[model samples]
Target: MRIRQRCGERARKRADRGPSGLSLLPWLLMGLGALSHLLGGQAPNPWIGAAGLLAFNTVYIAIVFRAFDRSRRESPLTWGLLVTLGLLTFGLAIGYGREWLLLFPLLGLGVGAVVRRGRLLPLIAFPLVVAVGAVTFWRDGWGSIGIVYGTFISIMVTAAILALDETVRELRETREELARAAVEKERLRFSRDLHDLLGHTLSVIVVKSEVVRRLAPRDLDAALAQVADIESVGRQALTEIREAVTGYREGSLATELDRARDALSTAGIEPVVRRSGPLLAPQTEALLSWVVRESATNAVRHSGASRCEIALSGSADRVRLTVTDDGRGPADGTPGSGLRGLRERVAAAGGTLDSGPAPRGGFRVTAELPVEASVPPEGDPAR
Candidate 1:
């Protein structure tokens, strides 16, 4: 059973890989009749006949082997060799009609291997077929269709199969490329989600834990409230991380703003939020929530701000969110991964994200979105 299965696997692989040079080599057996006549010593000019037979075999092997390589098959030298082989076939077939005429089909195999699908194919095939038919009729005195028909079939079938194999190889390559691109895209999404979820959640826990320590020395009830808030934040972080992993997470701006207020207040920065104008699409809300999460996290983590403000203004066509802090200004270097990921998310929704040092003092991050930002289909990461 094992031996049979392995044989079947090998056969499948060969079918996929298309024809090799060795596959055509077996057809050379057709020349055996001429070889027998030469060996038996019945024909005239026997020395020259042996040499001509040797030359024919050598040329045929070279043409068929080179045909398997695309560059060699299309070379000018291959065409030159093919033309030379055609002349040999005509000379032998016309000179010695009986067994040597089999060389015409061998010549047809050579022509099939060299010519690709184009005007050149029919141009070469038409005259070759017509000439072989005429020569066979003149010499064999009629009822000689077998050799002519074999030549035509050899040329056409070989070309058609090789053409199909080329197309199959190209389609296989294109599918592999698409699969790789999708894997990379999903990797980017998972990394961005983990960063946003952990970054803000950890910062909030740190700030409120400090507040609990300080207030415990003065007020028991207040300190316990802070600890309870810590538990709630931790549980919410767990749920959000689960959704992010499965690529089904959705965001609400109102929920994010409430969390931002608590995060900023616990960090000892006053939080002032203002909003006005039309309801937004789910995708637009999702993008704005990321902006708020990233901005509030940055204010708590980097800025020495005493107060931070988040503002949202919307019209029929567009909605914009801006976060500003009265603190030390944007961090000195390049934007971190959070800001970069948020920028990509916003841009994918037909929007923009910008962060820089505020003109008045501190830092500001701004995001704008089209009101009609379409929700990604279920289970797909937003764009």
Candidate 2:
């Protein structure tokens, strides 16, 4: 069983790999010649058989070699002549009682599996040749019944091995696809987190830098304080971004709300946040926090709105979060990169997010998460 399994594994690997046709043909021709010689009788008048064997082997070998040589420079004609010679050798082998000629079809099948690029002509031709050989053997009573049975088994086994090889190939392809998907998911997550971190921080820095520039000639103290605030905000942002980059960033709705308020305030926008939901599932909360940060950043950087509203609500089956700004809406009716990243993050958490111009001339982002966090019983805050 171990040997059979090992053979099957090797066959599968070979089928997955490409063929070396030139190298294979010589071995096949040599095997056919040896089989023919073995079955040739040793009688005194066996010169005719020997002569026929030698002529046929030489022709077959020449044809196979020519086929290999021309495969790079010639067309179907070379393969056609080689196959014809192979058929002639098959006939000679059977006529001389050469049971080893059975290797032809087996080798053909193996070669077909190796060179899987083109149409399956070799595969079909080999099986048909084997069928023809079997019929001839039955008719001529050349070999014993056991030989016929063995031939049938060999054909079946080859077919089974080829099928197994194809299955293994498909499985490998599936595994590769799954691995690619995993990598893509990680990339999306990293992009989303980076966007959220940098977008908010950069917007706040821009706003503070503008204030410092404008106030510098009028109020030196105020300008210096604003510059210091910028430095502090920049340091905090860098630390948080580093944590996110290192995969140590944890989500908290309260922390996100505070960050949102500070970011909007820096942009001279008032933020109103209302929360009435059950504590969210960790995944949902993480996604929602990203959405909050991204939406606030877009409002500060792109939307010219003066006020933004954030609301959260939950029920037994779902949770909903909405962020709205009373700023100038998108000119082209297209969500920007920040909003697009938010949508992807929400969708990955089995949620849906939509962002578009609100009817009242601002932008609106609404997301719904399907899973709800389990809440403790009333008055059981510790739980």
| Candidate with maximal TM-score | 1
- Cand. 2 Cα-lDDT: 0.66
Clashes of each: 0, 1
The true-versus-predicted C-alpha distance at residue 304 of model 2, in Å, is 2.1
For 295-316, candidate 1 gives per-residue lDDT tens digits of: 9999999998999999999899
For residues 1-383, write the lDDT of model 2, one tens digit per residue: 99999999999787665233344344455355444455654323356556655665555445444432325314565556455655655665556544445445433433333333335644665575566567556545665444444444444554455446556667989998989987676666667667678878888899989988999999999999989989988998888877866666766778888989987987799999999957666666766777788888888888889999999998877999899999886767798877776665566556789988887868999989876533112101111
Each prediction's Cα lDDT score? 0.85, 0.66
Error of 2 at 115 (Å): 13
Root-mean-square deviation (CA) per prediction? 3.4, 8.9
Q: After superposition, how far is residue 48 of candidate 2 from its true place, in Å?
A: 9.2
- Report model 1's TM-score to 2 decimal places: 0.85
State the number of backbone clashes in model 2: 1
Error of 1 at 92 (Å): 3.0
